[model samples]
Target: MAQPPPATMRAIAIRDGGWRFEEVPVPVPGPDQVLVRTHAAALNRADLLVLDGSYTVNPALAAREQPIAGMDGMGEVAAVGKRVPTTSVGDRVMYMATSAFADFIAIDHRLLMPVPLTLSAVQAAATPSAAITEYDALIVQGGLREGQHVLVLGAATGVGVLATQIAHYAGAATVIGSSTDPVKRTRLDRYGVHVAIDTRRPDWAATVLDATGGHGADLVIDHLGGNALVQALSATAVGGTIVHLGHLAGRHAEIDLDQLGRRRVRLIGSTFRTRTREELFAIAAETASALRPALTEGAIAPAVDRVFPFSQAEYAAAYLTSGQAFGKVVLDFA
Candidate 1:
């Protein structure tokens, strides 16, 4: 109802090329922006590299040369500019933020979307980045169609879950996923992941073939690079797609061109970092329609494996690398 105090707020900042938590001025919104008071922020694999001096995707700031690390977050609208017609104070919002580890963020009005009433703050925060990354690859790039089969690598991670759902939503006949853990495997069915095989087992590929009756999946989503590419190549139907989204397994990819050309396969790569806010908003709007029912009726909940207070941001970063969690790991600033 009233303006927040003028004093600075506690934020997780990276300065002197090191990760930190410090008191920084809460950002003020420009004419085309909104100010969000964050309730929760999720850790992304990208967030970990930025703190280690290995990430390079942050928007180049005039005052700061070093990249500020953050990609996904959830918060409430604390303030909005006069020109922003769609949002007002106290509206629970979720969107991409710059250096989202902070308690407050100033972002383009277009990037913020109203959180679905059924989704909690943590669940809302988990959806934007991961959902869009999968959307960009399978729907936009892979040309996934109804009746086609889809295979998603890194099936226990966030994007994998979204891909599995999107494939089913698109009317795929069957959707398969690869996960090493039995616990995580059980969660896939709700998302339309029809058959989830443990990649740790030597027969994972055989299981996919058996499930498809040797016709093979029409599309394969590879968020885990390296040998997963070879595995995708093997499981693909003669002219299928393999959408490359990450290097979770490792960046280096080894493949045989002769084998790939024989199948008329297509390979595409995606990074949501390069896409514009308008682009992201369009996809979110579509997903929002699909997400509303499931989000409200408990068909889906934000798969948050853990949450850490803002003070333990580094532990949150480490948790992502540990690969022990099934869902997202978040930092609670409120």
Candidate 2:
């Protein structure tokens, strides 16, 4: 453990239904936890849900009475609890934790991943949650195989970019991506997306089928749910898998179950919030290990769109909502 820590530190606080920066008490690490001085934090769409109170994090685990919002960050281990054995003080680390929109965060040491020297704090902060989500969806759940035709729906989002790269590295025969943004769609080719389809077109599924020579995608990772999910069924080949990971399109949609049944397509819904702490730690560690080679070789890296200072969290959130960012938006405390 380090010497006695400060009484309070600067943090992005949610008060009166809005975001504001304030000084809050520095959290004490529990027996199994470590105190991190966060250098950079990344925002996710879920953060907006949390802000609007649509997605409730366990109140018992809330960082303060009002709760702070953020999912993952990169920082230095400033202090270790008496029973925390894995991380030492002064270590550079990154981890997914609740209430990370602050200058400091106290998290379970088990969830931590050592930051690779090659990655800047911004790059490392951009990983963790996004990496784990893609690893689970494409590798563990989707069983994406080499030479398989894969389609990434909503491939302009943060997780979408990572999924495209992962599928390419997995040796997919054709990596197709769908995005509503015309400019982003064009850049998808630079990120391992072999074919970029405009989701605005009602016949994008037909285009995907044509790209695969009338054989639909072997794996369809759907980030847009609702009507888009129904369309994904049309893009999936018989016996293929469609991983429904996001509902950005909406929650409900009308679809033909007969088509789903006849095609023998498997639809899976995955979310990290439901995983046990131990399970999440395993996923994080495994993803880090699996991507180390790619990370070291420059085959995979964070596509950071913009960075905002800790005090400008409101502007950052607004920028994310503007939908101009093609990659992860980060909040830098340094």
Error of 2 at 71 (Å): 0.8
In the range 1-334, model 1's lDDT, one tens digit per residue, is: 6568456877766776567777888777888778888888888877777656665563521112223456778888888888887888888887765667777788777776668787888888887777667766777788888898899888778767777877777788989988878888998787788999876676777788889989788899987888777777878888988888887777887888988999888888776556665666677676666556655676555567898887888888888889988768888876
Q: Evaluated with TM-score, which candidate comes out highest?
A: 2
| Candidate 1 TM-score versus the reference | 0.91
Misplaced by over 4 Å in model 1 are 2-5, 58-68, 276-300
Q: Candidate 1 has which clashing residue pairs, if any?
A: none
* Candidate topping lDDT: 2
Per-residue lDDT over 15-84 for candidate 2, one digit per residue giving the tens place of the 0 to 100 score: 7667777888998888888899999999988888886777766443343454777887999999888998
Cα RMSD of predicted structure 2: 1.9
